[model samples]
Target: MSETTRSDVIVIGAGMAGASVADALSRDCTVVLLERESHPGYHTTGRSAALFAPVYGPAPIRALTRASAAFMANPPEGFADSPILTPRGALFIAREDQLADLTGLHNELQSEGNFKELDDSGIRKMHPLIREGYAAAGLYDENCQDIDVAALHQGFLRRARARGCSLFTRADVIALEELANGWRVRTPVGTFEAPCVINAAGAWADELGQKAGAEPIGLVPKRRTAMQIAAPAGAKIGGWPIAVDVAEEFYVKPVAQQLLLSPANENPDVPCDVQPDEMDIAICVDRVERAFDLRVGRIETRWAGLRSFVADKCPVAGFSAAVPGFFWLAGQGGYGIQTAPALAELAAALVLGKPMPPEMVIEGVELSSLAPERLSA
Candidate 1:
C-alpha cells in the first residue's frame, strides 16, 4: 500500500470552483487539491464565454457576482499580470414577438444592472450587424465586461500554491469515504485522508457525492456549444458589445477580430469530455444568420463544455447532512467564473466554521439557500 498523505481538507476537482475555494481556504487550512484531468481547467473553467454580468443568473448568483466585482476590478497584487476585466458592454435584443420577455427581463434587472431599454433605431445603432426589422427592441448594459478567465483561474491556483496548498493533477478519485472524524479519498496517485472534503467536481459532482455515501444533490450536466467565426468584411469589432437574444436562444460576442457564437443550448448530458454536436452547430448557424447580417463562411474553431446545475440553479456550498465533514461545492452551472471569488470566500468560511463574510452579507447573500442540506433533505 502507498503511504497515505493527510491534510486538513481535500478538495476534489481543480477547475475554477475547486481552485478558488482551495485558494481561499489555504490561508488557514492545509489543503490538498486533486484534479482528474492531466491539467486543471480542462473542462468548463477553461471553456466559458468569460463574461462578468452582475445582472445574470438567479438572485443568489447575482448577489455573488456583485460581491465578486471588487476582486475582478482589483485583484490582489501579483494575482495576475494584466487587468482581470475589460469593459465590453452587452446588448440584449428582442424580436417583436419576444418584446414581452424583454420587458419582463428589464423589470427584473432594472435595479441590478446599469442598463436601459432601446428602440428599433437604437439596436441597429448599437449593433450595426443586426438585420434591419429583425430586432424590435433592445437593452444596453454598460456595466458588463469580459472576464480574463485564464488569469483569474491561474491566479487562484498560483496563490493557493504560494500559501502551501498542494495541487495534484491527474489524481483521478476512484473512491471516497467519510471517516469517523474525517474523509479518505482514494486516487491513482495515493490514498489521501483529510478532516473534510469538498466536492467541486463540476459535471461529476453528484457522482462524487454518491461515492462518499452522501445523498444526491440532483446535479445535471448540460451541454453548451460555442464557435468562433471571422469578422464580416474587414469590420472593426474591437469595441462592439456582446449581442444576445432576449430569450437567450443565442448570443454573439466580439472577440478581437472574430465573433463568438452560441445557441445557448441546455441539452442534458452525462459527465465526460463533451464535444459539440453537429445538430447544435447547425442550429447555432441558423440562428446567427437570421439574427445578424453576417455569414459564417467557415467556423474558425468549435468546442463544447458542461455546466452542472441542481434544481434551484444556485450553487451548493455546505456539508452533507448524512455524511459529516463532506462538503458540497458544485452546481455552478454557467455562472461559475463570474461568481468564483465570492463563492470561494463563502466556502472557506463555511469549511472553517466562521461567520459569513460581512461584504457578502451586505450584498444580501443568504447562507441557507446554498446549504447542501436543502438538496439532500
Candidate 2:
C-alpha cells in the first residue's frame, strides 16, 4: 500500500448519499470520495423513478422529505439549466372492494395533510385511464413532482470537484483499520488515511460496516423492478399524471413518449447489479391491465434496483458510537433521490460539529435515533 495517500475525510460509495456527503464535507476539509463502480449513480440512484412527493411514506420519511424541499426548491447555483421539480399530480386510485384500504389510507393522509379529497365522479373526471369498474374513491396531491435526479447527482459532483475534492471511481475499499490518530483504508489503488470514514455504501452499508469492524445496523436491501413500455399508438400519455392503485401493487407514470411502470415489489436481495425477473414484469402487467382499460404492449426496457431500508424504514445518518470515526449514512429506501440534500447536510453537520437544522432534528430523527447504538437495542 502506498503511504502517501490521505485525506481529512474518506467516503465510500459514490451514489447520491455518498456524493452529497463528499460534496458537503469538501467545503470545509479535504475529502476523498471512493466508488466501487466505474461511475457514480450507476445503481439505485440512476434506476430511480425520480419523484419528489413529500406525503407518500411514513412519518420520519415524510419529515425528511419536508426538510429537503428547500434544497430542491432552489438548488446550488448552476446545478441544472432547468428547475429540479416539474409539476405532475399524483392520484391514488381505489376500487370498490378496496373501501377499507381507502379509508385507512385516507386516515393516514389526514395525519399527513394537504391531500385533496376526490369522489368517484371527480376521480373519473381527472383520470380517464381508470377502468369503468374501478375508482370508488381517490386522493390527489398536487405537490407531487418529477425530480431531475441526473441533474441533482451531477450538481453534487460538480460542487465536490469545485471544492477541490478528489473523487476516485473504480477504487473499491477492500479493508479498513483504525489508527491511533485516524482511520486507514486499503483500496484497490492504494492505502489512504482519514480522520473519519463515512459509510455511504447504500445497500451494502451493513456489510461495509462489518468489514470496517463496526457493528451492523441491520440494513436490508430489497429489490424493486421498473420497466418502460411502448406508448399506445397515437395515445397522448405524456401529459397524464402519475397514478397508482390504492394497494400500491403497481404504479405507472408518463415518461416522454413512453411509460415508466413498477410493480412496487420489495423482495429481499443480496447487494449486486440487479435485473428484473419475468415474474415481476408479468405481475406489473397484470396490475396495470387490471386497473386501466388500455391494452398492454411489449416492454421496451426493464431494470431492477436495490432500495435499502433500515429496521424502521428511515435513513440512519450519524457517527458510530461503537466504532469511533466511522459514520452511518444508509437505509434511505426509495426516498434517497428526493431527500438527498437535507440528509447530506445533516450528515455533514453531525460529522463536522456544525449545527443541524431544527426541523430535521425532530422526533426519532435526532442524534440519538441515528446513532449506531440503536441497532444493539
Candidate 3:
C-alpha cells in the first residue's frame, strides 16, 4: 500500500446514514468519510421518496423517526437555505378485505403519531382522484410531510466538513486490516488508518463486515422502483395527500406538475446500481390506474434503489461484539432518511462511550433495539 494517512475514525459510505453519523462524530473525533461513488448519495439516498413519516416503519424505526422529528422541524442554524420538510400528508388506503389492516395500522400508530381513520368518502374527499371501490377505508397522518432529501444529505455533509471531517469520494475500500491499535484501510486511491472503523456501506454492509473479519449480520438488499408520470389534465394536485395501499402493493403521490408512483416491489438483489424492471413499471401503472381516476400518461422518469434490511427488520448500530473497534450502522431499510438524526446520535454516543443524548432519551429511543449485538450468529 501507499503511505498511510491517519484519522481518529474511518466511515465507509456517504449516504444519509453515513453522512449523518459522520457529522455527529466530527464534533469530537477526526473522521474520514469514504465513498466508492464519485459523489456522496449517488445511490439510495439520492433516490429516496423523501417522506418524513414517523408512523411509517416498525416500532424501533418509529421511535427513531419520532426522535428525529425535532431536528427535521427545527434544524441547526444555517443547515439549509430552505425548510427541510413541507406539508404533504399521507393516506394509507385499503380495500374492503383490507379494511382490518388499515384499522390495525391506525391503532398501532396512534401512540407514535396522530393517525385518524377515514371512511371511503372521507378518503375521497381528501384525494378526489382515488377511484371508488378501490378504497374502503384509510388511515391518515396529517403530520407526515415531504422531505428535501438532497438538502438533508447536504446539510450533514456541510456540518461534517465545517467540523473538520475529511471526505474522500471514489475511494473504494479494497482491503481492511485490524491492528492492535487501529485499522488499516486500503482504497484504490490511497491508504488510511484509524482507531475505529464504521461499516456504513448501506446495501454492502455485510460485505464490508466480512472484509474486516467481523460476523455477518445477514443484510439483504431489496430493490424498489419509482417513476414519475404526467399529471391528469387540469387536475389540482397540490393539496393531494400521498396515497399508499395498506398491502403496500403501490403508492402514488403528487409532485410538481407530475405524479410519482411506486409499485412497492421488494425483489431480493445483490448490491449494485439498480435500474427499474419493466415488469415492475408495468405493475405500478396497472395498480395506479385501478386505484385512481387519472390516466397513466407518458413516463417522465424512472429509477430503482436498494433498501437493505436485517432478518429482524431493525437498524443495526453500535460496536460489533465479534470485532473490536468495528461499528455497524446498517440495515436501515427504507427508514434511513427519516430516522437519520436519532440513529446518528445513537451511533455517536455508543462509539464515544457516552450516555444517550437527552433529546433522544426524551423521545423514548431504545438503544438496545438497534444495537449490533442484537443480530445473532
Candidate 4:
C-alpha cells in the first residue's frame, strides 16, 4: 500500500496469462499483479470466443494447446468447482473449390495427432446449417470444447489471493526501469519493485518493453470481429458444432438462441475498445450465406477485439537476453484462452528455474523457439 513496495515478482497484466502467472508464482514468492483496466479480462480476455480446439493453429501453438489439454480436461486436484471445458465438437467446411486445400489441411492436422476427418454427412449432422452448396466437409479433433474463460481466470485469481498475492486493478503501468537488484515499474497507482517483470500486457506488450528500453519484439495487434444473428434458418445453436470455412475465411458457432460468426479479419490495430465495423459484419454474413444454405437475418449484436501476435505468431516466453529480469509472455494470437493453462505455467517455470512441467514442454516449445533472443537473431 505504500507509494513503492517490493515483491518477488510483478505481472504487468491481469488478464488470463498474468493472473495465471501470478497464481503459479504466489505459492513460492509474493506476487503483485497490475491491471490497467477497471477490472480483469476487460480487454481481449473478456472478448474471446473461448474455444479449446487442441489441433487448431500453427505448429508451436498447436503444441502448446495439446500440452494444455490435460489440465483443461481435468484441471488440477482442487482448481475449480465445475468443469472448465464442455463438450462441443468443431466442423470445418470445404466448398467444391476448396476441397484440395481442405485435404491438405486435414492431412496436416491428422499427421499431428488426434484430429479426425469427417464426411459430408458427419458435418451436416453436427452443424445442420450447412446447405446443398458445399462440396465436402472435414472434422477436427473431437475433444474441442467451449472454455469457461471467466471461471478459469477467476479460479487463478482465487488461488493467487489464497497464497497472499496482491492485485491492483486500474493500475496502468506507464514506465518500467531497471534497478541494481530488480526492476521498478511506475503505474497509475504507485511504483512497485520486483525481482522480475512478466510482460503479459496483451496488445500493449511491445509498448511495455519499449517503456523499459528493451528492444522491440515486433508485437502486432490484429483486429477480429464477431457478430450474433438469429440462428441460421433451421439451425438450433445451443449444441451445434463450430462451423468454419476451409480457407479460414469465416466461421460460425452456436452461442445461445442465436449464432455467432466472423469473417476472420486481421487488420492491424492499436490497443483500445474495439468495435465491429459494419462492412466487416456484412462481409461475414455474405461469406456465410455463400458457404451454407442459411439466409442472413437480423444481426443482434457485434463486437471486435485485438488478438496480439508476434512476427511469427508463436508466443514469446522466457527471459530477455537484452533486458535483465524482463520476461515475455505475449503474442498468444487467438489461442490465449485455450493455451493459458500451459503458457502461464511455462512462464512461471522458466522464471523460477524450475523443471518444466512435462505436459506443456512438447515437440516445439524449446527456449529457442520462444526466446526473446529470436527477435534479434
- Top model by TM-score, which number? 1
**What tens digits encode model 3's per-residue C-alpha lDDT throughout 142-222?**
999999999999999999999999999999999999999989999988999999999999999999999999988999999
* lDDT winner between candidates 1 and 4: 1
What global local distance difference test value does model 2 have?
A: 0.86
lDDT of 1 by residue, 159-275 (tens): 999999999988999998767889889999989999899999999999998999888989999999999998987788889899989899999999988999999999999999999
Candidates' lDDT values, in order? 0.94, 0.86, 0.91, 0.85
Residue 57's lDDT within candidate 3 is: 77
Model 2, 104-213: lDDT tens digits are: 97787775656787887787677777777578888887888999999899899989989988888888889999889879888888788998999999999999999888
* Clashing residue pairs for model 2: none
- lDDT of residue 159 for candidate 2: 90
Q: After superposition, how far is residue 227 of candidate 3 from its true place, in Å?
A: 0.3
lDDT for position 279 in model 3 = 96
Cα distance off (Å), candidate 4, residue 245? 0.6
For model 4, the superposed segments whose C-alpha errors exceed 4 Å read 113-119, 232-235, 362-364
Q: What TM value does model 1 have?
A: 0.99
Comparing 2 with 4 on TM-score, the higher-scoring candidate is 2
By lDDT, the candidates rank as 1, 3, 2, 4
Better of 2 and 3 by TM-score: 3
Scored by Cα lDDT, where does model 1 land? Answer: 0.94
User: What is the RMSD of candidate 4?
Assistant: 1.9
